[model samples]
Target chain A: MQIYLPIAEMAIPAESIFFVSLFVGCLSGLFGIGGGFLTTPFMIFMGVPPAVAVGTQPCQIAANGLSGMLAHLRKGHVDVKMGAVMLLGSSVGTVIGVFVFKLLKYLGQIDFAISMLYTILLSSIGLLMLYESVSKLLRKKQSVKLEFNQFKVNDFVATLPFKMRFPKSKLYISALLPIGVGFMSGILASILGIGGGFMIVPAMIYIIGMPGIVVAGTSLFQIVFTTSFATLMHAVTNNTVDILLAVILICGGVVGAQIGAVLSRRIKTTHARVLLAVLILSVAVRLSMQVFMMPDELFSTVVR
Target chain B: MRIFLVVLMVLLSAPVMAQSAVTVDLAQESIDITTGFNGADLKLFGVRDAPGRIAVVITGPQREMVVRRKQRIFGVWANLSGIKFDNVPVYYDFALEQVDGDEESEDVEARAALNIVLAQSGIGLEALHFETEENVGPDDLKVFQGALIRNKQAEGRFPEAAADITFMSDTFFKTSFYIPADVPTGEYQIKTYLIGKTSVKDVSTTNVRVGQVGFSAEIYGFAKENGLWYGLVCVMFAIFMGWLSDFIRRRL
Candidate 1:
């Protein structure tokens, strides 16, 4: 049941890889987020080299985004103009991010940096989502009505000079806001080896005032391009991508996403949000524990 | 002239006959690593003309490795410093057998005697040499080398203790060594020494060729040689699997 991974130069159990991808894929489908935040750390914990785990993830993420984007596209939920503008900014952000990643790698601090970044990102995002959901739940119990407001451009976002109209989302906002948001998400996606869906979806909702209907599809559209480009860049520059690992993950992930999408219909959105927040918080806590706790073997040897 | 030559040859052969003579051969000379290869057992048998003690040692190919020690920088553990060890054996195993002795006495004598032979012939794992990079101090070198050995032993790549060599008969003796699946494939040497009271009387050596075979080998080679192409292929494979899975899901 073990297969030899040529690039990583190690043998790992086939089923373990499949199951991890399946679980993450299910979460991605249910939450409408890329599971790279979970997959990268899990692979490292399972003994894949940190570089290979990071390098190989973009390929899997790109595939997942493509499949998910296609589903959303059929429902007329994507704004191609907005996605293109964001993608342009993402490309610039990804280049800068990859450079920083290489610098950290050369300093032998990549692992430490990655863990530190994840701890901060996941916990903050998870806590914020948890707070919002809990307050909404309380308001419902008190008979306070929740309003789905009509899309309105924020005063700060509307004032910028370069105006763009996205007909699909029925929004007229300065293009700079979306570009800035895309740039940040792109940098995060490359650095963390994630699709950055968690950050981008919320940004699209609050900052650009994009309707909820188009957010998921629009975000996924940018993710597919950014991640695919990142994968090729890492492969050519770092030579760290393990193709075998990507294939195994994609096999399970595609199927798991379908199952998750089907299951999402049965659950309430409030409950799903709470569960997702808990999962993210737990991963952050686990990562923090690893950093704070003493390791059993203080010395590690690497073959040159 | 023919009679005089025959007499000279007999005089030279007389000394070899009087003392012990040793000859050794492995059960197999080459090992093929297929996809199903987990590990393999090697059978080495040898004979001696006179009764003495025997020691067997196996050393795999040597390569450079880095040993890093994690330091508590602020609150988190990180790899602060490391030393590169040059010419370290990737795998090592040793076995010893005493012709005549009890357990307690043999343990003490065998160790004392084996050290002497190993030092002289430079044949066993203990005989291996290590050198450090320019920046590493002498004391630091010792710490790194010790850590290297300790980690390798924990990983089961190096033997913690030598196995006992069994003798099937008075003249014929044999020992078995296990090569784990994780053993790096390369040229290896199996050396058998006939140990005397003072020094090594005779030595025999055999070679083993360990390399990957079949489909796995082809893939491994491709990845190592054509890394960029390999990466491209892997990406394509991922896309294909993703597409296949999505298609299957829709049908179901």
Candidate 2:
């Protein structure tokens, strides 16, 4: 059935919103990732304005992150100190991001900016996942062992000022490192409307030298805060958040995540990664076609 | 009862008959956009005492609008440049009264004559005007203006082809116009033109009020007026939903 969204000022099929969130939520639960990379673009394709889609996403992501954070917290894997420091950086980053977003909206380039950013981000991330999963599959067939030794704390990251100790991760790192990393993801989260856990989790383990066990928990911990803060900022500054849209998406997403979390136990991780890679890549390709292909109507009009 | 009501309306406004040859009234004077309002079809029936032909035009709620052209920038189509126009109607629709002709009209010449009359009286699309201080050349303005009309037509805000103002009887002519759900809420004019051979003989304008009410209005009003509280409530709602879902999952 069609439902009118007040702030977006449009009527769309309620099931379409629910199903998109459900699919993305399932993927996020199956893989330990925030699927905003998929959800935001899907909404845009479904005729939600880029600003509304981006603005409304944070609350849904915040809610999804909370569930995951709770699970991780129970396992005692969250390094709250590290997550807090990163959140500090992200808060500043989100402010800058929202400013840029508003500027782009005024210039009427928000659509292009969102589309372009998604194309670049989704493609690289999808390709990386595809490559890693394929090689791992091939290696298993040949029984070749993969090495676990990853990043060394480079002298530059080690020597930066304001070193802080995170007892949970058992690491001493420069406070600036997590802050800078958090800041980058925060900008991305605000602009792209993704929880940014996929990006932030990797950065936590590789860049900040956090323990792998704590990385997911810490990333989820910070995502809840950053997304909540970003939602507030966009709602206040841009007035773009569609609360009704968020409600439908969150309702579908949370349930889907629960089901996905249950199904993840039975499914092989490698195959699922490959499937997800394909999905992400397909979205990127479609976005590229939308941008590069000649439109049937070359002129678009916007009401001011 | 409906026809009787239509006649009664004409008789009530008969006192102004000497001042103008035409008088028009809508089925509804005001429309409330309650929750789930899609769009509204307005029944406007009129009387034109001295008319070679009759036409109805509806316009309202002027707004600033921009028509942007797409250009390939870095191999991607982006909205590059735009012509901003002032005083553009957010809603525009018009229809001509079909001359006494065959009901199933294969009468091309008769329709052509009607078009000629509409064009001459400036009662149709080509006569619509918009102003801009953007220092644009006439050709660029024409292109953007045509684009604007085309877009609006596609959106059903403007009639692509003239719909007929059908006559119910010798004295009463009625036509239906749709006000789209997305039409900006404001004052609108429902004008019935008494088209003479080459000019408008008499014009009668009626007022229409479209306003948003109910849940949709409440939500939008709250969001715009109290952004901070709305945002906080949205966050809280989402968090609670998340927590509830997780709680349900564990119990299951």
Candidate 3:
């Protein structure tokens, strides 16, 4: 059935909207990510309009992040101090990003900019993940217990001033590092209309040298706040947030996520990563094609 | 003495014009758009003393629209140029009906039958163009305007073919058209034009209000005004929904 979206000012099939979110939510459940990168593009392709898709996606991400954070909180996997530090930087980034989004939208270049960003971001991440997972899978089975320096503040990192100790992470590093990482991810999240889960997960794991056990939880913790901030900013400034669309998506999303979580246990880690990589690459390719291909109708009309 | 002359001039012109007296009415004057609104169909009923041709045009409220034409730049399709048109109808639908099954000979008869005044009139969509104001590049405004109408027409917002007006009796005629659900909510004017031989004999316009009425209107209003609070509510609602779904999942 079709339903009218007030903010988007269009009628869309509710089932297609629900099923798209469901698919993305399933991916999120399987990959331990917010699935914004997938959902935003898919919504645009489904003719939700680029601005509405970008503005409303953060609501979905925030909900997914909060749910994930709660689950992690139960397991005590979140590094509250680290998450808080990153949250500070990310919040500022989100404000700047939303402003940029507004500027691009005013200039009528938002759709082009979004497609370009997706192509670049998805391609890099998909290739890197695919390479890493493939190499790991081919390395055979060795539980090589290497000496862990995940929490160790290296001499160079420790001397950078403003050293803060994260008791949960068990590290003393320059506060600027996590803040900077958070800020980058925040900008990315707002501009790209994503949860920044994929970027944040790797950043926390590799850059901050946080333990893998807490990476998902801490990343989700920061994501919840950053996405929430982005959502509000888009709403107040652009008025693109469609509450009905978000509700329908979230309803399908949460259920799909649960199903995906159950299904993930049956798949191997490398296989799942490979599948995600292929999915990401395919979407990236499709988006790039849209930019390069000649459109049937060269003109786009919008009523003011 | 001036009034007597004016009345005498009107009486003298009445027989010379020989125009038809027409009256038009819509089934519903107001359309209520609630959450249950999908689309609606309106029956346009009318009475005419003279029988020749009946044409109905329903046009929605006018608004400014920007039409952007993309160009291949730097190996990518980008919106490099655009033009803005003011006072363009957001929705336009028209129906034309010919009576008496005189389709082939009406053109010949229309030319040879009566003393029809040569007025500036015809069923041409191009004539719908109003004053244009440029907002962007030095491109032809007509091109963009035509593109706008073409695009809207393709989307079913612009009527492709006019419905046939069927006469129920010698004096009564009616026609109907389906309004798509995506039609923008606003005031619409249903114009009924009575045509004779070569010129428009008489024209009547009726107003129809199409506005969001209940829950949808309230939400739309809230979002438009209290955007920040609406955003907050949306986020909170999403969170609540997520939690509820998780709760249900656990139980299942």
Candidate 4:
């Protein structure tokens, strides 16, 4: 039996898709996630073709990110300088990543590579984050002091010749770090067809030692361009972008972002980090299972 | 005097009646067509609307073609739906023999059959079977058939009192038609038609042609084949690496 999805196709009934987007958007804003992790999988589950699913997720990211960024901007959480530098690097990296992506497709190993990589990455991140959060809680119960010792200056980053002062982050780091981060994020965005906000936010916070507020803001800033380029490139070349699906996801994500921003104000930083850690670990576990466990149906084809 | 005046008026009106016949001129005879990596733009000329049907015939290279319906509402243009056709190479002699000896009386019938066959061969109709249409509002339109598209409009309606039609499918297949890089090009004709209740209402045609070679085609072509998995894998890897670096940094 064929079922009609009126919300995605019909303008009048699009609110259904919008509501779903809103929910995802809120989570993206609250957790400082790109929501691509959730949205793309959800789209696939909804019977959308893989190509369309990947292509449309970015438009949703752009919309949700815009709203989330606006809220962060008002809170003075954005580091414009850091974001600008990162944007430059990401732009260059994304273009190169696109080329590499094409090569992989021509080779026909893209699906296996993507699945293997995602499984490994998500599971590892999830496990580590979960371990850290649990440990932190246990230590807090035992009356251990949580000092800011992680803020110590690194010689590798600090010794780089071109040092630039980040007034907002209150750090003096080499331009190389941001550029490197941008390059990595850009390649990821291009290859995975995602906004890369999930990776960028964590990098900013843990590696660059930017405050959580700035990390989230900067990540969103970079995501806008990264995903925009991906969207345009996909539309012109792959013709995979389903504008109908995009509209549905974006409407939902935007509303969700607004609610998420409001809820974020109430959550403590430590708790937020812990939640993020747990989320990452859970995704990681799921990915690892796919790699290690043989399927009941051995002949089952993996959806691209 | 009245009788003489009536006679004079009759003689003068006979010449005006002779000049009332309509004449149509198709500006360009043939066209070279090309398709984008994801989509293609098509145009044909010398279209005429009769009582119950609209017809377009072109004599050119063996190629594929898609016929679309377009509508204009509130000064905006939009595609309504489209049909695809395939053209097979045929000599004039073969075509004439296929029509049989009653050439004059069966001209219209023969033309219709040729058009249908060309359309069926060139443009695959698989996508058309699953097409869907949704009216969002004043300016939004969406059309889809599983993995194919008939037409889509976002901000405005079609400019004519007609529906804009577009044809595209998800299947990745190669075609025989190729636009040469160094061919001398001139204006070509694009034929469009409108189907109305009980009859074909209006027929229109436009001129379009390929010009100098540009980078868009190359860029678009490369992207179509590789963009999907590349974007997906790279982003996932970045997330993994970022977290790994963080974990290592903390451990040290």
Tell me, by lDDT, which candidate is best.
Answer: 2
Clashes of 2: 0
Candidate numbers, best DockQ first, in rank order: 2, 3, 1, 4
Local accuracy by lDDT, each model: 0.78, 0.84, 0.79, 0.49
TM-score of chain B of 4: 0.20
DockQ of 3: 0.47
What lDDT tens digits, residue by residue, belong to model 3 across residues A193-300? 888777777667666788788988888888888888888888998888888898888887888888888888887666788888999999999999878999888887
Cα deviation of B211 in candidate 4 (Å)? Answer: 28
Cα lDDT tens digits, model 2, B78-114, are 9999988897888888887766564667877766665
Better of 1 and 3 by lDDT: 3
* Candidate No. with top TM-score: 2
Ranking by TM-score: 2, 3, 1, 4
Best candidate, DockQ = 2
Q: Which ten-residue region of model 4 chain A has the weakest summed lDDT?
A: A1-10
For every model shown, what is its TM-score relative to the native structure? 0.83, 0.92, 0.87, 0.49
lDDT of 3 by residue, B46-132 (tens): 776675677788888998887788899999999898777787788887777754545566567564542232224424464476456
* Predictions: Cα RMSD each: 6.8, 3.1, 6.8, 17.6
lDDT of 3 at A115: 95
DockQ of each: 0.37, 0.65, 0.47, 0.02
Better of 2 and 3 by DockQ: 2
